[model samples]
Target chain A: TQLLEQSPQFLSIQEGENLTVYCNSSSVFSSLQWYRQEPGEGPVLLVTVVTGGEVKKLKRLTFQFGDARKDSSLHITAAQTGDTGLYLCAGADSNYQLIWGAGTKLIIKP
Target chain B: GAGVSQSPSNKVTEKGKDVELRCDPISGHTALYWYRQSLGQGLEFLIYFQGNSAPDKSGLPSDRFSAERTGGSVSTLTIQRTQQEDSAVYLCASSLFFMQGILSVGELFFGEGSRLTVL
Candidate 1:
């Protein structure tokens, strides 16, 4: 069974649009992380949130961790073509074991 | 190298053949994990190794799948009698510190992954 689940398995939007991808789970996590991956390369870390109800912003991209630490969301504003790739979320269990989400494949059409 | 390394990057083999995939984590990383991904699918946990403790082999799909981390540095995953269903991209990741308790929720550094295609 998948411990963490992601929504909108595939997304296609025009440049300058806004979109939100969500990751949810029933189990609370000690830490949550977001990663972006391009073809032919490994996923790269975008941010890590350790506290519930915490939000982090990276330029036009905003990430929020749910108050109960059981969910997270990534919102991208004024999406650019460069943002086209796969967005993945991972949660760490008490034992430091990471449970990964299925991922959201985002495409920004110019 | 500065990042985790994996090879051979791509492998194509026939059924019943055996194959080996290798991973070299960044220097000083104590935790290593192996995951498999099908086309456009989520990662599937394979195995995990942390420091000196025995590996967590619960994730291994079957007896034909096995892995080893030698000298607490390099790792190798071996698949015997490969089947077409075994085709997937095998990913390796390492964290600098996971033994320090909840305080240090080490972020994983990943390799590009080795793509295996069993015919």
Candidate 2:
């Protein structure tokens, strides 16, 4: 079983639309990280939230860590075709190792 | 400086054969990690090396899989008697430090993974 679960395994939306992807887990985390992976490449870090209830914004993308430290969410505003890719959230478990979610595949149609 | 670099960008081997994948971490980094990504799946942790101490091999899947980091720099992951299910992209990452208790959560720099195919 996956320690972290991501909602909406796949998302397809029109350009200019907004979307939010959720990552939930039963275990608390010391830090949660978000990454984006494109075709033929490894995942690139987008953001890392260490504090609970922390909110970080990177241009049109916003990431929020749950107050309980067991969940996180990614919100994209005015999504564009360039934003299409696989979004992954990973949390540092009790062992201080990363536990990953299945991932949310986002596709923005023109 | 350059990020992590992996060798044999793509490899193909028949079942029951052996394969080796290499990873060169960033300079001066004390931590290195190996992860495997299969089709339609998330990145699975394989192993981690910290400084010159013992590596964290808890994530290794089976006895057929093994890895070693030499001189605290380059790492090689070897899979003996590979199976078709082992086909996947193997990724390598490195960080400034691997300390967990000290809260040195350094961001990992990942290489463009090496794709392995077992037929």
Candidate 3:
């Protein structure tokens, strides 16, 4: 019953590599959000996309919302060791209830 | 508090015991959500409280798990007869919601989480 499907549930890469994680769903969402979490800490919001086909960039990280609003992607360029952590995506339904995706655990090797 | 606050950052209890976890959301944030996370896994929704409306408890795993948000502010998650399977980090998050549901699709501030370990 997981409405949001995130790909590459686990990823391990060396520093300086580029990577992309995806979150897809069959249902359209009003808004999509991405978060990054470190061990023993809460997930912190990275970006939120509302308008369909909108693209947002945060530093070296790029976030894109699907034109249909049913999917999203997060891309990181030149990954750093500091980028290692769990990446999560959440989509807000029409009722404003958020459906979370299975997280992607990323490990950046130095 | 400036951010969401959760009590008992870590808790360890024997099986079949009862436990309570508290959450204090940012003042004025009326939308509160509780989630559980197992080691490196995705979050499991527990419950959510919006304004004065009845909470959505559809995600509660069992009758042993219950939560209450009082006066649209603080919240408490109680687990009666805790089991080892209940061990996980309980996360509390708060968001600001306006008149419409669309406005509710905003940022969610989260607490550090309360880690519960049942033997």
How do all models score by TM-score? Answer: 0.96, 0.95, 0.97
Off by over 4 Å in 3: B100-102
What is the per-residue lDDT of model 1 for residues A1-110, given as tens digits with 9 covering 90 to 100? Answer: 43899999999999999999999999999999999988877888999998999999999999999999999999999999999998999998987778999999999999
lDDT of 1 at A53: 99
Sliding window of 10 residues with minimal summed lDDT for model 2 chain A: A91-100
Task: Enumerate residue pairs that collide in model 1.
Answer: none
Which tens-of-lDDT digit does each residue in B6-117 have in candidate 2?
9899999999999999999999999899999987568899999988878999899999999999999999999999999999999999987655566555788899999999
Q: Candidate 1: what lDDT?
A: 0.93
- Give the Cα error of residue B80 in candidate 2, in Å: 0.6
Q: Which stretches of candidate 2 lie over 4 Å from their true place?
A: B98-101
**Proportion of the native interface contacts kept in model 3:** 0.76
Question: In model 1, where do residues sit more than 4 Å from their true spots?
Answer: B98-103
- The model with the greater lDDT, 1 or 2, is 1
Worst 10 residues of 3 chain B by lDDT: B97-106
| Candidate 3 residue pairs that clash | none
- Which ten residues in a row are the worst by lDDT in model 2 chain B? B97-106
- DockQ numbers for every candidate? 0.72, 0.68, 0.81
On lDDT, the leading prediction is 3
